[model samples]
Target chain A: MSEKIDRRMLLKATAAVLGAMPLAGCDLASQDPTVRGILDSAEELTEAAQRTLLSRQSLAREFPETAISKHFRANGSDNPDDGDYQRLARSGFADWRLDVGGLVDHPLRLSLTDLRAMPSRTQITRHDCVEGWSCIGKWTGVPLGGVLQQAGLKANARYIVFYCADTFGDSLDLPNKYYESIDLVDAFHPQTILAYDMNGKPLEVPYGAPLRVRVERQLGYKMAKYVMRIEAVESFGHIGGGRGSFWADRGYEWYAGI
Target chain B: MVRATHWIGVVCVTILLLSGLQIFNAHPALYLGMDSDFAHPAASIGVAQRGERKIGVTTVFGRSFDTTGLLGVSGRNDAAERAFPAWATLPGYQDLATGRRWHFFFAWLLVLDGLAYLVFSLASGHVWRDLIPPARQLRRIGASVLDHLRLRFPRGEEARSYNVLQRLSYLAVIFVIAPLLVLTGLTMSPALDAVFPFVAPLLGGRQTARTIHFICAFLLLGFALVHVAMVLLSGVWNNMRSMITGWYRIKPEGSLHVGEN
Candidate 1:
């Protein structure tokens, strides 16, 4: 009996050490630049594979009204703490203007009322988060392509960058303003819209009240909320952290198709 | 081809499992519908304060269990409050982004390696001649199972080829469980859903697909454990040699088998 117990203990100890070795090895490997670069390449491979498999005009699945989630979960910044954002929210966004500039042939600043007058499309779609949760919500918005067309994107413009009002970071002292960017292929996709309403109601502050981009084909983080500016750029190398998006800067995949 | 793909698969599966656990730590919950109905999660792991002490609680289909030290919460002095112990996850820390990076890289490698193995197996007639049991073997499945329960593995000439139980299990792992894992994994990707709109719904829903993926991962882990035990019990050096060098030492006929009748 004692010998059996000894053997069991030895087995347990061996198993524990064997299990712990991988974790230690992986942590050390991840710190190596070459290892990280190899891992990062998978993101590009996934993007290329997905783009090849999907048509440029392929639309995400649209669901019926019954499919809408009962309580849509709001993530990231619920409300921008910036004073300008607060004041605009106080006045029901009457003074809020979406600046469209950068590589655009026609720089334009439009108010909420002007955007409301534009042709709108409403669709119910699933919002898949990077954290493995999903929510279905009905979004009503103007096609982002139409807005970009109105702004007259310059010949050099290759990417659309969305600058948001909300600031996000672990520390409030050095807040990183939320931002995201997408290539022209995704930017001009028919289903890509700047949503002003959700679930048949005027969008609430919790859900990016004034406006949020709805990139239906990508993960939730790609759909930047509290969109304050839409800039057409040749490249996003000069953007915050030089990664094109806030989350991407923090190691999340920029494409986010998966 | 088998030996090369087997080792590659071993490495890929190890990384995939550990990194997958890290990703699961981000939400630490599972659901079974079109979306995550947060109010009614099918299973979830969380930390709760009980007086001055914090306890790790794991809930499954509304039933709760205290799974501290091993799950829900674990670390040196129970400092970490994440689902799955730090030791079980890649990086040994909470970094979903890095975890995802490792997972995707290995996932692609695994798929590529699996494809190579499939092609080789088909071309070499390995699947038909080895993995598929004949009708006679199928009829004696009950007796084969009884033999396994008794730890009475085939010996001498009988051991030259895979036994019925081994063939059936290998077939199930390769043709059924492995394909399900891949299909369910692809179903969870929102981008794939856009192109193949019917995939997720056909499997019930994205959340259901996620659940199935998790279940399949555990099933694969279970198979690996049993496989290793069988390898050790039947003849560790011989089995390892066969897998490593495609040469297995078979005991001569009528030799007394150790630890068996």
Candidate 2:
């Protein structure tokens, strides 16, 4: 029994040493550019694999009105601290205009009233955040597809980028004024709306007043808040970091379906 | 085939652990309810400012515990960050994009490897013959436990077949924990949620699935630790040879070599 105990201790020591070996490589693994390249390739592979499995027209789950949360928690940039945004908010956004231009037959600068008057959709869908929280809210807005149709998208347009009023950081922080983009497929989806109202009331400032994109099938960060402009583009090459969204610029996945 | 799959499993699982921890740190809190209170969390593992110092706090079921050094608070003084340390995660920096890239890449490998192993084991009757305890072994489980606690192992012919404890642990990990991890992982994806409307609801909610995923990962980690320990204690060379090669030179009861039998 004593000899058995000795063997057990010896084995334990050996195992401990072996276990620590890989852990020692943690820093090395992170620093290795080769690993980073592999990871990037992996992300592309994942995106391709998921896209293959996902139908372009499949709608995200819509819940009953009763299931809507009491408070649909506001995500990133809940309130725009910018002076211009504050000035517009002071007048209840009466002067707010949503600019739709770039790669379009006709550029549109539509006011809040024009958007309200257009063909709209109301959907109660769950918002899944990248930070792992979820909330349900009833969004009433004009279908983005109809709005884009009015603008007459150019044949070269491949991505629709939504620029927002809310800005993060300053000149020192680079051009990180919250922006998100979706492929033409998601943009043309029936459920993709530019929400102007929530829970039977006009959108609160914290909830991105004036307008917010509701790409329900994706995670919450893809839903860029605070309406400013919508630019249809052939590619996001010239956009902020050319990765599609502000969060993407800050190292979050451009495609946040998961 | 088992050796190849096992090594791949090791690499993938390691990446998954580091990346998964990083992803968890992005939120640092989990909830059982469908809709979480963004302001406050029911359970959280992150740092909080306590006067001049940043103290780590881990809260569960509304109770808070100071896990300052390891969790909640990490790094030196002012440089301290929240939840998991950088070394323990994939990207090292707080890049969710890169972390996720590593996670999904390894996650697919893990799933494929597990599936292959499962199919192979089932078809070859390895699950029944090796991983599952026979009725006779089941009856001696109490003795097996006693022997294990006393550091006594089977010898000669008995060593060739797994004891009841080994069978059960292998069975539990291969069947229960692995599938749960995969299913719960799928439950969190919005696209998958769209395809299978029942997934999120059936699992309670997406947040709930995330919580379960976290829990399942820890369970897998625990299983891995114990599994490694077992491999060491059971005779590293012999066990490793059995896995790496098809043959294991099992020593007889009182001898160092198999031929002595």
Q: How high is the TM-score of chain A in each model?
A: 0.90, 0.88
Clash list (residue pairs), candidate 1 = none
Candidate 2 Cα misplacement greater than 4 A, ranges:
A1-33, A170-174, B48-53, B77-79, B256-261
- Compose the digit string of candidate 2's lDDT tens values, residues A16-57: 745754644654655567866666565576667678877888
> Each candidate: fraction of true contacts kept?
0.77, 0.57
Model 1, B176-239: lDDT tens digits are 9889999988888888999999999999999999999999999999999999999999889999
Q: Top model by DockQ, which number?
A: 1
* Candidate 2 docking class: acceptable
Model 1 misses residue A236 by how many Å?
0.7
TM-score of each predicted structure versus truth = 0.94, 0.89
Q: What is candidate 1's lDDT per residue for A1-258, written digit by digit as tens?
A: 997787568556755755755567789887788999999999999999999999999989999999999988999999889898999999999999999999988898998888889999999999999999999999999999999999899899999999999988864433399999999999899999999999988889989979999999999999999999999999998888888999988889999998
lDDT tens digits, residue span B18-88, model 2: 98987888889888766676666768987788898888889998899988878877766636676887667
Best by TM-score: 1
Model 1 docking category:
acceptable
